[model samples]
Target: MRERIVVTGAAGFIGSNLCKMLLQEGYSVVAIDNLLAGTLENLPEGVDFKKVDVCDSDFSRYVEGAIAVFHLAARNCLDDCAKNPVDTARINVMGTANVLQACVEYKVPHVIYSDTSAEYEGINMFPSKIDSVKPMSIYACSKRSGALMAEGFKNYYGLNISTVRYFNVYGPAQDWRRVIPPVMSAFTIKLLQGESPFIYGTGEKRRDFIHVDDINRFHLMLIREKLIQGGTYNLGSGEDYSILEIFEKIESEICSGIKPIFKPELSGEAFRTLADISETCKTGWTPQVTLEAGIKSFVAYTRERLRLG
Candidate 1:
């Protein structure tokens, strides 16, 4: 029998992509989602999918016999989380506790927790390392709380958990429906439609963008090698680009002749984010996708989607 792997938030961008990759690697996947943020169309075929919320009391049954679990479900939008901090805490903190409990109950061998680079919002340091974190926003705080919960599980229950903090991940199935979408999706979609995209702030906030494929490659390595137990890894390209630079790159590909409309800076966002992946590199898993190649493919993917619709 194929090894069983369960993924929460399976209908979302990263989860869906991970499911596709896991299926390709011959793992029996069980996908779970509440459909709050993710869509059915995003889910790939050939896996057992359950419409279940992470906070649901009965969510543990899905973990039975699974070799590993990827807990990705959370209230992650900055604005949304700011507006509904209570709900964010309920899902991010409490829901994570429930997932960890299930993992312990089921005796699952390992768990991969989906974390964010937003943990560094309050830190002014460049090339963020995993050693220090100071989360400022409600979303980041809640995720930090969840990370603390994971730490407790590792220390108390010996759950063998691996936490991955992602930096500006982008690719297909990217969430473009939020009130404020991701930068790549927002810029590409608007440009493709001949509409000018909005650039929050001065369009100079630097971010370390890593292609989703590179992230998934690291994930696969974690599963296959099981090299790190009770470890935290930073997944990024180790290169930083300003928002305007990204816009220019995308525009260079589409030749849209459209300029971005600058607006007030969004609150609770860092001025820059660059990852220090030295420890992760020691695991022999280096980022393979270049920003230029990644952006070109993303532009093509977005253009094709717009054309189809």
Candidate 2:
């Protein structure tokens, strides 16, 4: 009678890591991903995995009899989504709606939906509050639309759902295959190869980073504690660092003399992101990993991956 859980986007970075943690905790896991941006190499062992897009209306069958569902699939590149708003909405919005519909239909008792701090892109306020959101870009709009869809299910169907807005999440197994890879991964990949990576913008844009391990800890809490199941939590370290600062941390580990090249700022990205995690803090969860530790591990992991391949 081990509770089975279904995870969308299981082959992606966060999804794969979450699956690993769930398996270690003895939960029966079912995973789904489209493989468009995710890879099987990131897919965890000891789970029921399916190659399917969340947008597929028939995707509901995957949710049958699960104790809970974790929906993490999305068309989630800000710059890319800005360029392709239609596809962005179709996947981030409609696909989320489709998954919630399945959870409702299949009688799944709970769901955990992954949101983003990008919802606060338009606001100039420091330590952005979860409730004071003002999403500006089409990408942010799409993510917000998905949350609205989930809200509808909560109101009408009485479905238990926990939503979380993640700040800049980093660690090993991050989605390096992204059209525009995450800053940490992109930099590490290039630096590991003795190449100077381009630093988009002036490297002064600040970001609140939370390690994937910390996020997974929160995810476990959402599953075990009913108190964590009904509200949106901001997953961040409550501290902000500039892009250049993060680069320096990574560089300190490698000591590469290759200076980064500066480039024009990318559109659809926020100037600063700092999370107000007070609400989430009440859940007794705090981000445990340090930036230096996180970056060092990531660098090591990336180096090993490259060496093996």
Candidate 3:
């Protein structure tokens, strides 16, 4: 019999991708999402979707007979968390606790958690690793707290657990407000309208952008192969690109005539982020998409979505 997998945030960008991969691999998937930051249209047809939040869902019912539970649901929006820290905590922290409780009660064989590089805030270090994490924002703090809870559950309840700290993930279905999407969208919108593309704060801030496809592959490979157990690994490409560099790539490809206008930098945004995935590298998983390729793919997706090209 095929092992059943319970995936929270199944309607989300990465979650839907992971669910699709799992289904392709012939695993039965019970996907649950509250549609907070995800859309029902994002998930593939035939997925077992429950329109309930992790905090409110009867998670045990989903985890029952499932061999693994992949917890990916969270508030996810940094700006939203900054605006309403309490609500963010309730959903991210409390919701995670609920999921963990369900996993423990159901005796799920393994749990794979989705953590974030934002958790390592207030640190001035390059190539941040798993051991070095200092959450800065309420969202990051909540995620860190959830990670600790996972650890406790593993130690006390004997639930196998692993967490992956994902760096900047960009691809299709990304929200328009996010950095990459907005940049691409704004540029395309302005270019077709014959206006200058805008840049934020001289556009020097660098970030490690990993394609979501790589992340999806990593989740399936890690869970299926069991290369990691009770450990945390960073999922990134280990390559850093600046905001200016990304803009330049997009403009050069789509609209070379238009220049970029500078704007003040946004507060609370990470100035730089680089992931050192040496731990996951040992497991033979590395990001395959280059930043240039990723930017092009995002531009193409956005163009099609907006009917700009």
Candidate 4:
């Protein structure tokens, strides 16, 4: 029998991609999602899917006989989280605890947690190191709460766990339908439609964007090689690009004449984000896609989806 891997947010953007890779590697994937923020269309074929929320008391049954449980389900919309901190806490904090409890109860050998770079929002250090976090937003706090809970499980139950803090991940099947979609997706979608996209702030905010393929590569490494256990690693490009620069890069390819409508800056967001991926790099992994190449692929995918040339 092949490895049975359970992914909590199997219908989500990154989660869907991870599931596809796992299937390609011949693993039997048991995917779970409540469909609140994920769609069934995103899941690959041959998956044992259950429309389940991670917060359920008996969610652990899905993890039975699994090699590892990849916990990717959470309320991740930053602005929405800011407006409804309680809802955010309920899903991201308590929900995470429920998943961890399930892992412990099931005696799963390994757990690969999908953490966020949002935890570093209040810290100004460039190329953010995985130390001394200062989360500014409610969403950031929720993610931190999950990490803390994971630590508790590690200490008490001796469960093997590894955390990957992602930095602005993007690629095909990106969530372009959110009220505030990722900048790259929003830009490509709007430009392909010949509409002016909105820029929330001055478009000067710098962000470290990593291609989802690059992230999946490391995910494969973690699962197959078991390179680093019980450690946290940053999944990023180790390079930063300003919002305006990213806009220019996308616009130059999709629709040259479109201009973005500028608006007041969003609250509870960091002005800049750059990941210090030195630890992850030590394992002989590096980002493989260049920004231009990545953007070109994004534009092509968006155009095809919208039936545009």
Candidate 5:
């Protein structure tokens, strides 16, 4: 019999991609999402889906008989988390606790948790490592709390839970509010209308942008290999590039006529973020796609989607 896996937030970008991979690998998938930050359109075809929030009381019952659980649901908006820390904690922190409790009760053998790079904040360290997390925002703090909760469950209940901290993941189905997608969207829209797109923060800040396909691939590799237990790994390209460089690459690739107008920095935005993927590399996985290639593919995807609609 194929192993049963439960993926929370299965309608979100990463979750949907993971679910598609799981189905392709011949695993039975139970995909549950509240459609709060995820949508039905994002989910892959021919999978079991439930429109239920992770924080709901019935969530525990859904975990019964599952072999493993992949918890990815969270309030991803940093600005919203800053505005309402209570809601952030309720969904990210408490909701994670609920999942952990269910995993324990259901006798699920393993739980893979998806953490974020936001947790590696305030430290002046370049290529931040997994062990050096100093959360600066409410979203980061909430996620860190969930990581600690996973650790706690491992210590007490001996539940095999591992975490993967994702860097700036950009590819198809990324939320438009995120940096890369918004920039691409703005540029594409302006190019058609003969206008210029704006850039924030002088474009000096650097980020370690990993292709979502690579991220999903590495995650599946981790699960199949079962390398780590109760530890965290960073999933990234182990390469960093300035925002200006990325913009120039995009402009050269897609929009050459329109110049970017610089704007003031956004509040609560990290100035620099790079991932140290030594741990992930130990798992025999490395990013196979280049930024330029991924961006081109993403642009084509969006363009085709628009044309179809």
Candidate 6:
């Protein structure tokens, strides 16, 4: 039998993509999601998909006989998390604890926790290193709570866990239906429809955007090599671009001739984010996708999706 891998939030953007990658690599994927923010359409075929919430008491049964578990389920929208902090905590914190407990009980060999660079919100430093983190928003704080739970499992239960902090990941199947969507998806979708995209704040905030494919490359490496056990890593392009810069790049590809509409900035977000990937690079995984190429391909994908709809 092929090695089995369990993925939480397996219908969401990154989870869905990761499931596809694991399936391609000959692993039997058991996907779990509640469809709260994820859609059934996003899930790929051949997965033993269960419409289950992470916090469900019976969630442990899915972890049985799995070699690894990727805990990606979380309430991650900044605005939504800010407004519904209680719900966010219930999902990101309590839910994560439940998942870790299941992993511990089942003696899963390895566990991968999906973290975010938003942990650097209160810091002013460039090229954010993994050691220092000061999360300011509800979303970040809840995720930090989850990370702490994972740490506890690693320390007390000896659960081998690796935490990966991602910075502005984007690609096809990116969530475009959120109350406040990611900039890349929002801009691409609006431009494809000949409408003006909204730019929250001054459009000057700098962000480190890494393609989803590059992220999955690093993920596959971690699973296959098990290079750094119980380590925290940053996955990013190690480069920062302003919001306007990203808009220009996307507009250049689409030639939409539509300018963005300025709006008040969203609260509880960092002004800038850049990843320090030196340690991650030592693991022999470097980002393979270029921003230019990634954006161009993403534009084409968005156009095709719009055309189909």
What C-alpha lDDT, on a 0 to 100 scale, does residue 254 get in candidate 2? 85
Q: What residue runs in model 6 are displaced by over 4 Å at the alpha carbon?
A: none
TM-scores for candidates 1 onward, in order: 0.99, 0.98, 0.92, 0.97, 0.94, 0.99
Which candidate number maximizes lDDT? 1
In order, how many clashes per candidate?
0, 0, 0, 0, 0, 0
User: What TM-score does candidate 2 get on C-alpha atoms?
Assistant: 0.98
lDDT digits (tens) for residues 168-241 of candidate 5: 88777766645434455555545444567777888888888888889888767767776555568888788888
lDDT, each prediction = 0.94, 0.90, 0.82, 0.90, 0.83, 0.93
- The CA lDDT at 61 in model 1 is 90
Candidate 2 residue pairs in clash (backbone atoms < 3 Å): none
What does the lDDT read for residue 201 in candidate 1? Answer: 94
Please identify model 4 stretches exceeding 4 Å from their true place: none
lDDT of 4: 0.90
Give the clash count for model 1.
Answer: 0
Lowest lDDT 10-residue stretch of candidate 3 = 176-185
Clashes of 5: 0
Selected candidate, larger TM-score, 4 vs 5: 4
| Candidate 4 positional error at 118, Å | 0.7
Model 3 pairs whose backbones collide: none
TM-score of model 3 relative to the true fold? 0.92
* lDDT of each residue in 1-309, candidate 1, tens digit only: 999999999999999999999999999999999999999988998989999989999889999999999999998999999999999999999999999999999999999999999999899988999999999999999999999999999999999999999999999999999999999999999999999999999988999999999999988888888656558999999999999999999999999899999999887788999999999999998999899999999998988888888
